[model samples]
Target: MAARVDVKLAELGISLPRPMQPIANYVPYVVTGNLVVVSGQVPAIDGKIAVTGKVSWSVSVDQGKEAARLCFINVLVHLKAACGGDLDRVRRVVRLGGFIASPSEFTQQALVMNGASDLAVAVFGEAGRHARTTIGVPSLPADAAVEVEGMFEIE
Candidate 1:
């Protein structure tokens, strides 16, 4: 049987890709005590950047939202690994940090970040409601439209 979170993802028509390997010197996730800290994830599908460039410039707001969503899915991938492939071990989504690549005038980072936030709630239900910080950045690695990192409490 699938885990409840996996079922939820399937219901949403999302099939998580293989977790992306860290491109730099950091591990994908680190478990300390009962917490799992996921390194920032970019919008990637099948090991390729799915979305790139800045929002409100090369990427539309809607596309940016989708990018954010993909980033969150990647976060989940790492989280699942940290939990030993059992998402059921997750207790709560502690926090999410969002970075939106956007122009200096772009002020809708929160709205764009909702893509990830909404998916989190849908996947984890009440436990998904989490504190978040979203900010616009001038650029990101690989020019990804959005990046997300998370902290999760696990059993």
Candidate 2:
């Protein structure tokens, strides 16, 4: 039930931040059948990017990881909205896609994405374990250090 999940989130000291509106034309998430496909989210909090710039250049690997975490938190904000405010509707975290803004030589993308991956497990237990892809890119919207998107199975 969402109550349990809400309590868990509270216990974890995570209060879902306000959902960010699409900076472009796309909607935040689309529900088709049982799946909610979320749009990519950058590490924004309080309507501003929490971290920016290329990883391992101006940003450290740890900072990249934290940015990934912040992005996931933003993902949850929309995911909850897509679920009609009942997070319990989510049955599983099917997959996560992460894009790390980093130099061409950076190779620690997967490790940095662990920030989102780990939090998913913490929130959904076994259901949070998911297939994932992590990639390096030259830049992202707002020049955030990381961006994360997700696919969720819902009921």
Candidate 3:
């Protein structure tokens, strides 16, 4: 039987891709005590970067939001692996950090991060409401429009 979260994802038409492998010398997630800290995730779908470049410059706000959404989906993928393939083990979404690659003049980082935040709530409901920090950066790995990292409390 599929986990309830899996069913929810399906209902939302979200098809999680295979968890991305680390491009550098680091693991995708780290488990410490009862928490899993996921490394920053970019908008990679089907083993390719789906969105790249600076937000509001090379990428539009809507595209950046979609990239953020994909980043969260990737975070969930790492979280599922951390929980041994069971997302139900998650107790709470502790925090999420978002990095938006934008031009120096761009200032809608928070709005762009809403893409991931909204999905978090949709998937985890109240538990998904979490502390978050969003920042605009000049660039990110692969020039991804957005990158998201998360901390999840697990049983």
Candidate 4:
């Protein structure tokens, strides 16, 4: 486990919760060979969507970005649990794909995704940095403000 991750998480007042199971057909994560694919996780906690609605419309861009941060936290929780709660087991983050619910006019998807990308680096240092994409969409399940999925290289 990396001490920097713990330090950053504490500094940010962030706590990773228990890993959650999928609500429907798909699994939360699937590990194939050295790659781990985490399903899209919304801004949820305790089986409830933490934030809902479209960015810059029903929700502010900042709020939506925070929601994106939470989704990334959830992804890390799942990853840690799968690897026996040891971040050292993760070699690196491969890709981060983010989906934001926003109006047609919203163009701050990249800025919103900074929350996730920033957190990843803060946690895993260089290994946490990865290729990423931020996409806008009409709506998401549970009407979540943001959703994020990830791929990681594991040891």
TM-score of model 3 vs. true structure: 0.97
TM-scores for every predicted model: 0.98, 0.97, 0.97, 0.92
Model 1 over residues 1-155: C-alpha lDDT tens digits? 77898898899998878988889999999999999999999999999999999999989889999999999999999999999989999999999999999999999999999999999999999999999999999999988899999999999
* lDDT winner, 3 or 4: 3
lDDT of each: 0.94, 0.93, 0.93, 0.87
Model 3: lDDT to the true structure: 0.93
Candidate 3 Cα errors over 4 Å, as ranges: none
- Summarize candidate 3's per-residue lDDT along 1-155 as a digit string, tens digits: 88888888999999878988888999999999999999999999987889999999889999999999999999999999999999989989999999999888898999999999999999988999999999999899877789999999999
Rank candidates, lDDT, best first: 1, 3, 2, 4
Question: What lDDT tens digits, residue by residue, belong to model 4 across residues 27-137?
Answer: 888888988898999888887898999999989878987898889999988887667667677889999999999998899998888888888887888999999989999
lDDT score of model 4? Answer: 0.87
**Residue range 73-138, candidate 2, lDDT tens digits:** 999999999999988899999999999999999999999999999999998999999999999999
Q: What does the lDDT read for residue 64 in candidate 2? A: 88
Question: How many backbone collisions does model 2 have?
Answer: 0
Better of 1 and 4 by TM-score: 1
In TM-score terms, which candidate is top? 1
